[model samples]
Target: MAFLDIDALVGLFPGQGGYRKGALASFWDEGDPVLRGVLAEIDEVALRVLGTDIGSQIFGPAAAIPEGPELFQLAVYTVSVATYELLRVREVEFGLLVGHSMGEFAALVAGGALTVAQGAEMLCHRIAATAGTSGGMLSLSCDVRRVEQILDLAAEPHVVVAVVNGRSQVVVSGPEQGLARIGAVADALGLPAVRLPAPAPFHNDLMSGVRTEVVKRLGRVRCAPTRTPVYSPILGRCYRGDDDLVDILGMHLVTPVRFDTTITRLHEAGARVFMEVGAGRTLTGLVKAAHPQVVILPALTEPAAVDTEDTDEPVDVPSPQPSTTDEEVMAQLRAIYAAALDYPEDVLTADAHLEAELGVDSVKRIQLLGRVGRHFGLEPSAVNGIADHETLGDIAGQVIASLEASGGR
Candidate 1:
């Protein structure tokens, strides 16, 4: 299958603003750009909602911001909305929908518990409200029972279970001191633990301030019935109504996420494909570790070979693999673009106008620009003016013009 404009999905991850172009190119080359496109799209949303560099702070692109106590909730909403959009587009059949941390919101959105625009607005509200607390979260690979015992023994302040990602992986959160205590405990226990690059401690008591605000926001929005099966990390049951969505979403902001259990149960129920819809392969990695027998796919990931900081890499270019012949090159380019668009190839021609003939709307044009930029090594910025190209032949002619400008083939 030809690559879809996957790089466009970077709008999903918040911390990845610094590497957008490089990230998109690498994503396209990975042969699975759907996830990339979803992530890019979500990142765009994050920038629009939080302004400035909120996404960077959340994803460790920079230092964490003090969002007061509601910071956790804000983080959750951002991640959730991204996932929601991915699931909304495919609506693929699955035995269960599982989310890690704030990803539960995505599950709810995918299962039809919430509307896309509503989810986006809610995420905005969450981030705006939670910009108060300064904290972080940590993930540990250890025996859950032992970890719980250690938590009890240490009795640290500002510490709580954030997520149970697997039998061996548990995410903990709270204040810095409490997290430090947990880390010390984990070290003594011989459990491998790493502090997550999050802005605030999520799924912990420190986020109590987020609860009232989240509830108030929930009151302002009406959830719809779910069209797909969604397993709640809080209730540990399948939910299908607005009330359930509200309850789960509200409680999830404070409750520990049981993603491990949710995934296990889903697999047991016969779910084979686990698709990480928006941003990063964090969930996919966890699922693979948790269930080695299960097949998991991440929508986006950094290709190991690509250097994210290399600006010299062709911008907005397509895959570098050359076509067999000149005619084949143009035909293949058209095929790649058609497939990238998920549009019919029969509707396209070398001289066909992208806008007039292919009906390349603005959104699609932007998406195409992302692909074309990758293919040609051209970095895509907001193009200021319409190019003079009125046909595919015109586009090809421009490519030749650019190559000639650089004294090329």
Candidate 2:
């Protein structure tokens, strides 16, 4: 690849929720000093701060994704900094750097504000501080204006508009009840809404207290000015030498991530090429959604076959307008049943009966509910109750109702 002009290559460090085991296998296989040295420091920090060799949790094979949010954060931070180091050695000069949500720490490290170990330790501290919140995040496929309408529709809204990732995509985080209400309203408007299986409600008023804990836990660590211009979307500013790092990072948990605005500002500053400098293409896809004309790069997107497995992403039903058609909802439902039953999606129509037409009796439903419930993140009772509803549309209603009554995001 030809080197882009200086200050033209924008490094976009991703924040959270994209993890694949052994994502760094390719890098490790190269025995590159940059990757090796960064991971070594991070492992020491993990041992001192988190009491586990997260290196194994990160580099080893996985039967499952780590349920703990801390491991996920640490892994992403490690990969982002290591990848940036590799690029730096190859003489790929970054025109600018931006960290998305969790990716801020990585960017901070890459920009020389924090050492690799310091970044990992701080991230682990964040994962620990993020626990015990009463709510989770709900992702929506609508624009910011629609979110205000949804908030007004909910009686005594408890949720806060947390993230505006793309022009149309918004994520709200708050109490479970508030999220439930928001989800119901979004569904009625034909907007795609799904509760993220996140442990806590972050980037909202409820998280304000977490700031104190982060400052307290930062302990001996210190922040320096970045070698490269490091911009934070959550803070909506660039990190400076004299700025209070505590105030910036602490407030990150409480303030919404203005990713959309940050991207706009970055683009205005002449950052045309955006690179998701970590695992997963989530930020890549989001960047595309917001600005299709800009260049997007991935530091290490292709997973090595050595010890990684692919996971299915949640399917989104395309609805150009606010209201969902019966057909659109059925499309998503059909994909679910088809995957579990190993049947073609064409066979799973709205009017098809689970028992009479599809031959899914109570006994069969008991088996099918497991797979279906996992897909929707529903409880056994919720999934089993869905089986009682006959037609595909009826099952769809039950699923929506479950989302409405759900207390977890």
Candidate 3:
């Protein structure tokens, strides 16, 4: 049972529920206004815990949301102890299964029900379950019947009602024209409707006939059960260990997902630990928000501790006090540089260009500047001449000088 690296999972599933890194950062930074604040906090936690490892970089800060390393950690913690042993030894188990969506493939592969290559194929085929299907996902604070009325008004040639989330939120998908018509009706009714940040509309009548396509793909793949339990979102119950997965998997393409009920049933069935494996806190956060008593954790946040060579007792350096006014500013500059680089003061040079000398990239530069601004807790743009600074030390000097000029302690 070898432990699965979170980054490997990212490489495995590209452009699925979430974009890779480039899209991830933007999604957090600017993509969706609603996700910005939440993403920022998530990013902070990620950087602090994961450091600058391959998993974090590959997943990035934003796109990582759906299937981020954090979710993988959660799965590791909550899954069966035997599964943990397999992960420890890089072995596979076939008895473990997943709840729904592409996440199922990940769980199946991890459980050894499917080979890694088979999992990859299944995921690719699963994409067909929604590929090229034009429809929009709208979140509503109502149930399916009410949502259908909104869809009825839209009455476009291509509209399809999609997922039903929780008691209040329902997502609709169909042709954009139909969706637009629906939106107008929703507006007239004064009901809030927002489009989802997804590429394809899913789980509607539009996919009802797509089973042939899915069955063909599913047949080509070999499957087995380690007798792992699969909780069906559609049935609001668990499929018997020996239930026919092939048929159920095909039907899933067109079924309405009862995620809320399924989760509730899991708890009722005594599933104390709910680990949302793969990526994103989407499920875990929802689970935690819905059921705060449950323990929710993600794998990405379990960052490997910093590696050090010496085991000797560490020595603490005395705090150095400046002997003069200029020296005080210099000391502050050193502090600023250390904080900006997330490194030691000895590494930063006053004249060294931050980008060229310290090798800071665009993301790192923005993060550093953001940190500096927060540390000063003022309008960073107010520091007029500091933009021309070459290094962290220079920026620090300008910041301190401005603070002093403004009578800031």
Candidate 4:
């Protein structure tokens, strides 16, 4: 049976300053029932946490800037949850989800692992627990290996790589002195690095104390199984039904985020379309750099009015069938894999072993299968045996089998 065009939706939650100026005003003026409902929920939580209406703080005349670390983190969380609700009301469906740093709580809520109320409470507690910790984060335009090398050379005990965002982008977190040392090293190498506007050194050993407290609190809080699969880059895998949510979330505080690997895994799992669900284009930009061929849509862009009515719904885009002949299918598969892997078409052939001959890594193999799945309109289950295919010819055979199973001509 032919399935409805299934596009993988990835929800992105921004870390800081996600809601730009006038964000509240836009939500109020639009008067979307979904937005209103989300606002009310957030306001209720804000009142309990901040002892004031967050709506007024954000939308009132002479709006107060989110100054304190705790308040700023709360603002980011609240706005992200509201944005997620707005998307849900519009019938946006997510196949897989991920978040950056503080955005993980938002991802859990969106994925149904936690309710909005639970998420708000957890986030507020996290902020409160980690508030006085010293140190900060710095973004570096260098690979993880190089960053580690620099850290090793510097011998700075406090600083550590906090995130592996992409092939060339990483974030390091530590005290001011450690950061200055790292910056000097980057300068010597002529690499660009900038200090992130974070109030504390998050996703590092510095937050171990906070992680323990949060985990204990999470144990007392009830959590439901996830509806949408939420991948934790920190844990380097998707949250399974049997896994301990509290332990996972607790460890997430001290683990470095392997975002690059997360994207690869999602693509391998047949996710082709990624959408940034929250207030900025940060995650969108990272995804683009990681996978240029996949479709990316941003739910919000700064300085532009959010018009929920005009957003295009994801529909299955048709793929061309070159021919049904075995030889033709093999040729087409080679071409697609070559293009996706940035290798010349001649480098791949029916006899070439995907790994030994073509240098196809595990992540690249997953990407290859996803592309094939989309091209021939195969069901996700149809591609489940992709790991068994060792050579180009072997993959071609599986594709032919899937085509026949799907009643494709």
Candidate 5:
């Protein structure tokens, strides 16, 4: 099982429904004492940076935390580090380490390139350096060439394709007006588009100022050669021990994420079991889409039964629940979305436009769909038409239809 570090930011919150809150809790409950000590150290750093207990915010009752690019990035970094520690305590091993977007920092820590505290500190400085930049990103359900053609047609050169996630998914980032132009072009091209909830256009030339500052700050942090191989999609290859971590990571801010190519390379390198180490199964789904034959698992949400035979310790994770009625499914989904998006349950009615009215972005949309797929025991591809649904009611109806078709209810 070649463990793949799923980016924490892929999922909005760990404990929220549609997410495996129990799985996250079990890690802390069943982990070694050293795991707890590591978490305590991380908590102290988090308190200093955030002025609040990040552990409490994530592990406590489901609630909305401060929403912004910097804070969101920090929360992702915290959960990722904790998840990595839990995996280490569990004695899970990986042949290679890869992270999506900000997940690279967690990969570095897990691969022995940086201490948890050093990684956390670097993330804090990263947030500070990139703060107040003006721009946004949009996810287009089209290939890179199509997006580039659309941009050319619209005469919008500012918007650059920030991430090539898959054959059908590409993320573009630039000035707000440029993003708007891309949206219009996508609409005119009849391509599905969703605006990401980003405060600035990352992985694009818009972040040049951020890059310079981050590079200078990153040089001050001590980094060692990675213990495990770390594959960098931003650099389009594996990171040699002698590579300049500071320059590569700094340039990562303005370079496009070639995840599609990265996954292919991993497969070529003989990685069969891809395990996502963080909050959600976003990367899992993407990996499945790109390489369907590979075994994919979510480290934060895997059932204990699957691993009991490998370990001497007993595992006590919950089993899958019995199928529920359509109404029950709808209600559960509503609650999940509400908790995940931090919106009132009442607002997630049949008529509410998920994107327009509720401001749900592509990342959150993927999280919601991933949760819905798990809750109902559906395949990852089962939630394909999620974007076509305009309202919660529309989504509920789709889920019901899928359930009925699958004989799940």
Candidate 6:
């Protein structure tokens, strides 16, 4: 079926492990112009960096996708960008976009902060930056809370949660000893821990040196203001105009991504339609777990591979926050926004649009939020970290968090 959705659509870009050969078989067979153009732009940059175009590895009649980490990453980036372009050509009106781990590079391109060629260039630099680093990552089939227990059991200080994909998906990064300790603990706890064939520990303290190298190398490729409104789980906020793009992108090398929170935030922001515009269905599956009520689409019409797990237990889709405090928070937020906008509190419903229906612009939002911040004594960072202006409920959750956090202070 065609990916047709009128609701607020969210486009997801999955990272590293989301690649497979022949991902774009149908697109190539159909002679898609948009896909061709995107690949051409990336090949020009890839040829200069790797001495051969990435297109030669992913496309054409006789393509041999290399087993090396660098090549797999290149293919993932290329396929993701190309897939995004194909969707854009089809006029898929994505209301919000997000990237998982390294997939943020492609999201930046879609968000207009980076060009397609620049995304590919940054990926190549990323591959080069961590080539010499050591250690590995292990995926644990349990929630982050359970993973924390494993970490405590392991007593490996360097071990850290590198990626929280969903309720039951977590990947930790650390040195070999740290990883071994965690694995042993996980085995003891009866939780499955699969070690990745990662030559370098990603998004952990071990990447501290590599982070600086990334910033220096990508000094020429800073992300100029984003236009498409992208939320970064790694950064824990949307890309602000004043954000140090090069630095944030650099820091991501060592910063873990709270992707489960990203999905929850997007769902709060009035997004009920989602699609994974990449090479694998991993992001789609994670989205399904986070917001089971929302509609989700696969990576493409024909994907080379689909992500799977070997667990015996069935996946449990989590329900929304059932606490009475959450209901109170939403009601309190409606009153706050209603009073600020001079609208009747009854009309300031959860689904009320902040921009289209309420006529609140970004500038007006900043000014209004500044007043709310002073009135509630909310933290400046909390008021400023608003990711999107889609609905009152979207900003409500963040504001409520700020209120709760600053209540004691």
Q: Which candidate do you rate higher for lDDT, 1 or 3?
A: 1
Off by over 4 Å in 1: 1-95, 242-244, 297-409
Compute each candidate's TM-score over C-alphas. 0.55, 0.72, 0.50, 0.69, 0.71, 0.71
Question: Model 4: how far is 270 from its true place, Å?
Answer: 2.1
Among these predictions, the greatest lDDT belongs to 6
The Cα RMSD in angstroms, rounded to one decimal, for candidate 4 relative to the true structure is: 18.2
Q: Which candidate do you rate higher for lDDT, 2 or 6?
A: 6
The runs of at least 3 residues in candidate 6 whose Cα sits more than 4 Å from the true structure, single-residue gaps closed, are: 1-6, 303-409
Candidate 6 per-residue C-alpha lDDT over 204-308 given as tens digits, one digit per residue, 9 for 90 to 100? 978989888887788866567887788899887778888877788888888898988887777666777888877655676677766667787655576344333
lDDT of 3 by residue, 35-153 (tens): 33323433343344333222243233432322332333222221222122323344322222344444554445445465544544444455544456565455554667888776666
By TM-score, who's the top model here? 2
Predicted candidate 5 versus true structure: per-residue lDDT over 1-409, tens digit per residue: 2433432112111111112222355555565465566667767876776565455644445524434556656666666667777777777777677878778888888888989888777777777787778888888877888988988887877888888878877899999898877777666655667666676788998798898998887675668888777777777766777777778788888888888887777766566677766655556566777777767655755441111100112212222345667678677877777766655688678786564345453545655665666667775445654554657888888887877787777
The deviation in Å at residue 401 for candidate 4 is 68
Clashes of 5: 2
Query: What is the clash tally of candidate 1?
Result: 44
Off by over 4 Å in 3: 1-98, 128-131, 141-145, 152-161, 239-244, 302-409
The candidate, 4 or 5, that scores higher on lDDT is: 4
Worst 10 residues of 5 by lDDT: 304-313
lDDT (Cα, tens digit) per residue for candidate 1, span 49-121: 6663334444433434324324434444444454344444665344445555555555666666765455655
RMSD of each: 16.9, 10.3, 15.8, 18.2, 10.0, 18.5
Error of 6 at 242 (Å): 2.5
Which residue pairs in model 6 clash with each other? Answer: none
Instruction: Please give the ranking of all candidate structures by TM-score, highest first, separated by commas.
Output: 2, 6, 5, 4, 1, 3
Better of 1 and 5 by TM-score: 5
- List pairs with backbone clashes in candidate 4: none
For all candidates, the clash counts are 44, 4, 31, 0, 2, 0
Model 4 global lDDT (CA atoms, 0 to 1): 0.69
